[model samples]
Target chain A: MYEAYWRGMGDRCSLVISGSEVMSYLGGNPGGACWFLEPELEKSIRRIHHLVGNAAAQAEDGGHVVVGTGSTQLLQAALYALCPPDQPEPTSVVCAAPYYSCYKEIAELLQSKLYKWEGDAHNFNKDGPFIEIVTSPNNPDGLIREPVVNRPNGKLIYDLAYYWPHHTPITHKADYDIMLFTFSKCTGHAGSRIGWAIVKDKEVAAKMTKFMEVTTIGVSRESQLRAAKLLGIICDDCQAFSTNTKSQNFFDDSKRLLTERWDKLHEVVKRSETFSLAKFPKDYCLFSDRFYETHPAFAWLISNNKVKDCASLLRGHKILTRSGNRFGADATYVRVSMLGREEEFNLFLERLSTIKIGICNGIAHIN
Target chain B: MYEAYWRGMGDRCSLVISGSEVMSYLGGNPGGACWFLEPELEKSIRRIHHLVGNAAAQAEDGGHVVVGTGSTQLLQAALYALCPPDQPEPTSVVCAAPYYSCYKEIAELLQSKLYKWEGDAHNFNKDGPFIEIVTSPNNPDGLIREPVVNRPNGKLIYDLAYYWPHHTPITHKADYDIMLFTFSKCTGHAGSRIGWAIVKDKEVAAKMTKFMEVTTIGVSRESQLRAAKLLGIICDDCQAFSTNTKSQNFFDDSKRLLTERWDKLHEVVKRSETFSLAKFPKDYCLFSDRFYETHPAFAWLISNNKVKDCASLLRGHKILTRSGNRFGADATYVRVSMLGREEEFNLFLERLSTIKIGICNGIAHIN
Candidate 1:
């Protein structure tokens, strides 16, 4: 987990050297009375100011709220600060089924009872007396669910992790009570470990900030500065280019690769009558409709071993993919991220064909 | 605050750019679901493994803990995990007076009642019935108290922020339940916003970890990796470089610089003869002695002149310093951080001497 943070932040080479210097200074030299002088800290903070815009702007605009440490740390702070230790326990958290696995883990960790609302690929009603987590363009399946924005009963916490690729360019319009975004998914910088929250209420923001103060002291000043710098460049590029060029390119690449693989997978499933597949939503940014159509049977096949589950299939072919079970889906439904290069996608498709044919022949021979 | 973290890690220009690139990819990109991909996460985690040391070793030895965003986060987590929510009230925290200002803030923030034990610099005792905070070479005054290896009646939470610089070498031998360390103070990497606590008790560590899991999800994976890398380098250097050369050189520079400033300040006080000075413990690190001797009159001068405090001195001389009152010390005692190159230091000394004489004369004239 720690390493991922460094990588995500783009600290590849110097981390060891810097760590060594710190250990040496602390453990060996022991300079009197002035070891607390943090020269680098001042510099890093100054640099981040440029990236995130004026710190004052963040306070005033209710945006650019860079988090401390991991987004999880902030999440915990939000729960603690908003829920109040003294108040009656929160009724429950309403989470979309097949949501990010950690949402449940975090809720459970906070001792908040979770209420899962299963929904189709299109939309999920946000109604209940609980905190609602609307993860747009859901994970594993990559289907975007337009929020039921008018639901007034529960507080809304939007995890727009995959929303960038699937939804229209409406990030500016997302005026939620609290919205979470991370650096890992969007930019392929999984190691930077930076995240932010766009929060509306001042009281809630203050509580969250205080909670952050108690929890992490603040996010890594270094990470924030770096994130701010990168974000600045991105924003500039986005503004200067005719369209949201970077995002469009990303979407195009993702779609082309995903569609190519999905078609191949569909052909294989059709050929192998014994094996089944899960269908995908028509407007989905990932997986195809053909897979979703046969989802029930596919689920049974995976459970009964008529065909190998996603993890096994991928592992067997030295290909790595996420198991559907982690996302509240059947074991048979595996999410094959199309973020890979073209050759890698081709290889995956080839492997899927071979694996399905082999599984069918093996079953027939046994019969 | 955010920028300081990166600077603390000692990241150079090129690495900063690359780090920014990674940040953009992970954070600013569209779809933002990249964090969910385990492969990317694994790559980051693997790097951190090398930086922090064998994860296996950390698990086995249980001492090699990675830091989160800031020590405060870990502290909050500890409180949350250890303190029962069902309890009627928050836990009571006992702290030594003139301790780190944040200790009190954290306790209060947690809704815990704080019990402060004021201590005389010359003669102090360490017996309490609360979670005692023993800051070795304490803040504000730089006094290193004896260790409490066995707390028969209460719990001990030690803040070793200044522990590294005061002694000949940093020693992790002050057997306590939880020991806090920060890179900002120790490594001059305040901006990194990374801090960790070494908890001897497994239960405490587990609870803290669980709390952390929910809060920030984990510290920025990127920052941790960078920290681990930096620490690893320092460790390697400590092994390779003999203490005689590197250690001596390091301390000699700091001692020479600090002693010269201290002597100069003492000479100024002696010449002025307007206020009496207090004596400090031989092992004390902060400039508390200087303040104790000279501050009563300084306070009178400030009050009479309607100058708010020492921080206002910046307006007069373009010199920045912290107000001592912030550290639970006399309001008149302003903390002048010794930061500057030699020439700058000389200029500061000259300005300080002039200010001292001018202030004394003005007081006398007014009287």
Candidate 2:
């Protein structure tokens, strides 16, 4: 999705790492809570968040930046940090309905005695203590969400991966205790596998660092240095430009790209009687200084009553999509990624627009 | 330790990554057993192992290469893959006494229900199912080791990190079910945090890959590419030279450096009344086709009874060494690193040579 923009930047975004640079596990961030986080990367993370106003000021909020392999590692680290090891039973981990599916898988992968995935937050009632993952501009359905089960004992891990201005409106600075952000979603460098958590509490931050240490012995220093350089480029561009200028600023250009994609997707969905999409209200984006509807990374496509399994239906048509059932929803819906290459996305739109649902012996069949 | 060697190589070993080269991950290794394990890296890994004659031939043995964040994560993955999740009790995980302390911590860190750390394989009795870690040319003691607990149900994870020719002789091609290696110890690229496990079973490899996916998504693409490049250089050097060549081949230069350090260390230990070093018998290395004494990355320094806490004694002398007790050994033994920079190693040797044990009011003290 973001490869073109980066490719266009060319040598300016290129990273040249010397043979001897960052050959030790310990990075240059001597004062950082996370020992392995590079100081330059930390600075870039804080600056980006400050510029976007999606997260509270790092210094004022006492936030410590902890880098991980990706938000995937950070999520697990957060679970490890928040949940006490000596707990009598595994603490119930719940997320709202239609949440990111991997939450359940990641939480339960180790069969960790510290925590257990108990499914949807709406169904979570018998919790002495729990963890609610709030993925605003949620994975399958792109709706701005708040904690469904807000309780004093319920710790929250706010996955702000899709909270960027291009994806959705940055309504206000989030002052959450724990927030996870990834370079993958932020800049489409998923291959880099760089993610970080902005944590408020010192002890939690230390514990997260310990988790990183014990797990992978800390992230790759090469990745850290590269992320720092790339992020620095983005921040530098934003600083140089005051208003929305095509190709001048990263966020502006990305927003323009996403908006165009969303418009095309809306047109396809409108013309096709077989599918429907959620209608988002126009919200004022503080970062962009304008009103815009949410242009999520994924489109939650709802099939008409004739189709029972939307994902299988699309699969038959040679279009790949994740079934909504994976996100604890009915299989009638499928989550189509809006963040593929332009040509791929266009082909998917073309395929989706031409699909016809016909009744064959009282059973709906794709023609 | 190896920084100087890499630094001297200059641009020949340097890596230049363009912005869009490996952005989406799903690396160039589409046919690899591990989805994200880059093709170039897998080839290099197999080639190195083949060149060194450490692990069995990858193709002939049906071995699948699983890249990890480091051997740290790979160890956990091996444990995850070997242990059955549905087992009534956590599978006993044991290593020999004076094992790497991290094995105990990492195994029990998550309080995982699948496996539990049962210290010292020698002490491991009444085990129905168990996983034994055999760190040949072992961490603290630098002696070639095999699985202590030999049983039908006992699975083995061979940590051959120090099994390289420089550290120890490759007496035979290791044909273990699961063999672990690291770039850190192999090429002295510890900061890269890249490690790989060569497994005979496809199921085990798939499970390990799944563990990587759920945990940190996968290893960094940049690090993989860098390791591939570094390994390629090392292989190319070896292929170009038939015999030992100074500064021309990686292993030859490294072994030369380690030999010199060990010689100096042996002299210091021989002269000092407070300390004694292990005497390893000369063994024929197939790669070099010569008999050479072990010159490990670490020195297992055994102190005289008068200096009970050798690590503390060294700390007082301004030398940092891991406490022997940390490796489940007595306080009289401290593991001193021979892998530090030349200046630091010299300072340590100078301080170590001058150290004297004194009795102050019947209690032993370092003077």
User: For each candidate, what TM-score against the reference?
Assistant: 0.60, 0.97
- lDDT tens digits, residue span A90-142, model 1: 43455555656666666554333223233322354534444556776555444
Q: What does candidate 2 score on TM? A: 0.97
TM-score of 1: 0.60
The 10-residue segment of model 2 chain A with minimum total lDDT is A239-248
Per-residue lDDT of B1-367 in model 2, one digit per residue for the tens? Answer: 8899889989988899987778886887766679999998999998988988888846878899999999999999999999998999999999998899889889989999999999989988965899999999899889889889898799999999999998887889999889999999998899999999999999999999999998888899999999999999899888877654443878888999999999998998888777888799999998889999888889999876446777887888898998888888888889888988899999989999998786677578767
Scored by lDDT, the top model is 2
User: In DockQ, how does model 1 score against the reference complex?
Assistant: 0.21
* Residue range B30-78, candidate 1, lDDT tens digits: 2221221123323333332333332222333344242445676666655
TM-score of chain B of each: 0.63, 0.97
Model 1 clashing-pair count: 79
List all candidate RMSDs to the true structure. Answer: 10.9, 1.7
Off by over 4 Å in 2: A243-247, A359-362, B243-247, B359-362
The DockQ figures for the candidates are 0.21, 0.86
